[model samples]
Target: MGRLPLGVTTLALFFGTQATTGSLETASTVSAAAMIGMAAGAPLQGQLLDRFAKPVVIVCFTVLQVATFVALAVAVNGGSATWTLAVLALCQGMTIPSLPSCTRLVLKRAVSAGEVDAAFALDTTLMEVIYVSGPAIAAGVTATWGPQGLFLGCAVLVAAGTIFFVRVTGARWLGPDPGQAERAPDKEDLRPRPHDSRHWLPAGGFVLAMALLAAPFGLIECALTQFGTEQGTGLSLTGLILSVTGLGSIAGGLAYGTVRWRTGPARRFVVLVLGQGAAITVVAVLPSLGVVWTGLTLAALCTVPLASICFHMLDLLSPPGIWMRMQSWGAVANTGGHAAGVTLGGYIATAYGSGATFALVGLCAFLAIMAAMPALLNPSVRRPEPAKVGAHAE
Candidate 1:
């Protein structure tokens, strides 16, 4: 439910900005504004996750997000000026916390170490499906009614989704209604040490992993869009490429579950990560457009699989009750890396060309591999302990 609103808003934001602004520079900046908004809110959202009932937080933020998007639509279509857009953009950013955090929270409870990989694969695949479907829906709306309609429609859907999610998730408010005393503890305290040093390691490692992983793919996305345009493929064709990638992600997720890989996740992760880079390299070096497209397809195939493995690793590794926070942190890391990638890619593409930029993407993947070597090599990274269960007031 959370996914629907976010997906719709993102698509509308990206496509709508492109239509209204007509300048890649402006559109990219708008996109960055939205992303930065989300990034800025991550830590606060994480704190909320630790403190509030997941469903309540989800519903509240979801409503805020949809409403903000509506305001944004009004600002953009009504010509309310740049300040209105900035305010709406920042408000929409606060809504970014609920969806991914909820998914990771569920995984923490329902999935065990053995199933973490499959869970991540499934999660990544679902995210891809959302990306594919949402943008197409936005495009259809945009095609019929112009870009502003896209935002209006997205806001409506998001609002509806939030309502539905709250009703469905069966989340109750955590604290005493208004003024009741908190529940008494019946068991020993299971909370972390107030000054625990160990807690930082998992968080730091997860963040680093996501940052590294995001770099290549982020740059590749920019380069691929350029590549598509260069190949005389229209915007519709670019959409098709992304949709095909989503289809591949679904297949990859199903296969990950079916295969139920027995070996440690690290090897599979490294292999798929490199494979993704290799596929991008093929696109960079290959002469024919067909080969390049095929390479892009293959590159898409590599994405969800590696992400799935990493998510699973994180599930196994993070402390109990910290799932939402950790997930948010990973997301923030990815967003940060993507921002960096865009900046770096733009610079490199301007200096050398699109093809060389793709090559640099491959180099980023290599660097990520190197960055993760310590955890990837150590078997101790996969600790198999259950998170101690107790009432966390928050």
Candidate 2:
């Protein structure tokens, strides 16, 4: 329920603002501000989730999120200034709950070591489902009740979902008291630890790899949209082409989870990155849209599996108590890479066309593969012994 409303709220922000202000530029500015806010706020919010009680942090953020959505809806309807709308949008993004990271943290505690890979993969697949279906639901809501109704509906859904999630997961998985965890010894402390120099190389390398892995996705999305426009194919066909990639990711994630691979996540990570890059490069040179669709779908088979691998590796590597924070930082890296890819892709698409933009997407993937190599090469960076179930609960 919480995840589903995100697409509706996002669409309401853009289309509702455009409807009221009659300026695409204003809508774009508001949307960009929200993205910036999310990128900036994720780490901080993660810290809060790590440091405080789960229920308190979640409830507080939900209230703020609901208020921001309602305020933005009112402002848009009132024809408020662009700056005011932007501020509200930014607040909304900042307050948007980091439920995915929270879920990962819970899974780290609730699932057995033997089941970790499959659990994470299932989580990744669910996320893919949300991304694919959320927009379609948003479209339906907007068509029936308009953007204002959609915004109101989003607010209701968020509130209801948060209450339900906290009620269901709070006592069972989140632990009885975060204070007990907080009062544990220094070795068991839940606070963010000071950085140790020895771990920097692997940690920094992992962050860089994640960023690089994400950039090609943004580039390809922009390139595909431009390709569709250039072909004069309508939005419906273009959306279908893009949806194929999501479907591929869902399939890949589910299939990956069903297997028990002998190799470590680090090795699998590098292989998947290289394979995806090679696939994209091969397809980018092709002239036919049909081929592009097929190639992208094949390439995207690596997407969610890569995410599952990354998160699993994170679980292996992160110091006890900082899992959520590390996950948030991972999100920040992805957001940054995606923003850069979209910016570069836009300029390239405008100047050189969609084909060139697609080529750049391939280049970004190869660059990511290079960034990931250090993790594969560094023998000293082995996974730590698994924590006992419920060892790091909040």
Candidate 3:
């Protein structure tokens, strides 16, 4: 429910802006503005979520997000200037509820260490499903009722989802109660010490890795659209290919979750990243659409597992107090990477070709590996024990 509305909102913003202004460039800039805002706001919001109660933080942001959406819709329809629309879109992105980060925290608290992989896999798989269905629903809503209706529908859906989430999870499980501390005396010891700077290295590395992992996706998406246009295949075919990619992600995530891995997350993550890079590089070089479809699907198979492992590592490594913030940083890195990649990919596709845009995928993977080597080599970065029962609250 929380994420479902986002697809509608995104499409509504792009198409609504373009329809109103009659400028494709302006619409793209407006969309990029929102991505920028999201990247800028994620870490700050994470801190807020960490410092405050979950229900309060979520409720506050959801309301702000919905208001921004309505305001943007109104402004766009009113024939507002490009600057005005961009500012509103930025605000809308900034206020989006940090539900995914919160959910990961909840999962970490609720599950055992051994089960964390599977739990994260389920979360990733659900996200893939949401991505698959959300856009199709958005397309239908736009066709029937137009962008305005889509905007209104998104607002209602978000509000409903937020209310339900808070009522179900917030009331029953507030942040760590006094009893929790008594039950888990060693919790403080398990936490990363403030004085140990070494503990933060992995976090930095993880953020870089996440950014690199996401860049390929953004680049490929833009490149594919360009490719479709050049081939006269149109947006429908592009959308279909992306949907198929999502299916591959779902399959990979589900399979990864059920299995018990012999290797640690660090090793597995490295292998996946390298493999994804190679697959994409090969796919990009091929001129045939059939090969593009098959290659992209094969490459996409790594994405969800990579995400699941990253979250699992965070749960295992980060201190309890700042875990939410760390998760938020991950979100920030991803948003930033996608935004950058899209911008760069557009230029590359226009000047060079769509195929050339994909070559960046391999380069990003290589850079990410370099950036992560320090943390990956650190002896202190080992798998830790699972959370003690009742050690934390939602």
Candidate 4:
């Protein structure tokens, strides 16, 4: 539900801007404007869900998100000036549902820890499909109707998903509705203590891990875009490369879910983190477009396994009662990292060439490993206790 719009909007950002302005620079500004809202909203949304009823939190934001997005579609397609469009973009982000956090929250309650890997894997694979199809759908819609149609379609889908989600809760199958108030308060407070020095480390570590993990992704995406530019195929090759990578992600995520790794998660995390770096190196050093493409695909393939492991680790390690907030913090890390990666990668690609970005990305992943080392090494934090019966609120 969240992904439908996210995937479409990623590609639609360009189409929406160019539909009126016809400038890449202007397109970037528009995209950044949208990012501003998403960046500001996602963590806050996560915190709200942790503090309130899941349905209540989602309904509040979904209504606002839908309204803002519809208005944004109008503003962009109606040939409103860039500043107006930027304001609309911010509004859209502010109200967006922060679906990633919500979905993960649902999954946590839906499946046992043992079952979670498979659930996440299935979701990740579906997400890859969405990532591919969403852009294609947007492109087709834009080519036939206009950017306005593309956004309208996305807005409608998002609204439908939200509505369906709420109705399902009324039936009462998986997720709890009354939310966090029933939880044991001694353990589950949403608000953090300033004097709780131990809490601060985990917060910083989670953010750092998420940010570093995502940073390279952004840098590599830019590198791929630049590769297409160098090849004179414009943006066509970029999509092809991304599609191949998405396939790789699907494969890796499925495999990771299938195998129960014997090693402690922390150790496996280090290896996976290092593997991600190696994947980048493979793409960087390899010659021949075919080989390079394969390497990039392999790189994408490595992505989800690491993320899955990290997510599982987070689930195991988060303090009771505030898991949703921790998840939201991780979300913040990813959003911030991706944004930083794009800015840094664009600068590096401009000055040092696309090839240089591979090294930069690998370096960031390496740093992530370093940031994660302390947590990973703590034997006490390795895995969580058995599932408790009363964790979920009625």
Whole-model lDDT per candidate: 0.66, 0.75, 0.76, 0.71
Q: What is the lDDT of residue 138 in candidate 3?
A: 70
Kindly list the per-residue Cα lDDT of model 4 for residues 231-343, writing each as its tens digit.
68778888788877877887888877666444566776777778778878776676347766877777777788777666666655565556666666776677788999998
lDDT of 3: 0.76
Question: Each model's number of backbone clashes?
Answer: 1, 0, 0, 1
Please rank every candidate by lDDT, starting with the best. 3, 2, 4, 1
Candidate 3 deviant stretches above 4 angstroms: 171-191, 226-237, 285-287, 378-394
Better of 1 and 4 by lDDT: 4
Winner by lDDT between candidate 4 and candidate 3: 3
Stretches of candidate 4 exceeding 4 Å from the true structure: 170-195, 227-236, 384-394
Task: List residue ranges in candidate 1 displaced over 4 A.
Answer: 17-26, 111-113, 146-148, 171-195, 199-202, 225-243, 285-290, 377-394
Which one wins on lDDT?
3
lDDT of 3 by residue, 160-275 (tens): 98888778778445464222321453544443454468778766887887888778877998889888988899898788899889999989999887776646667877898899
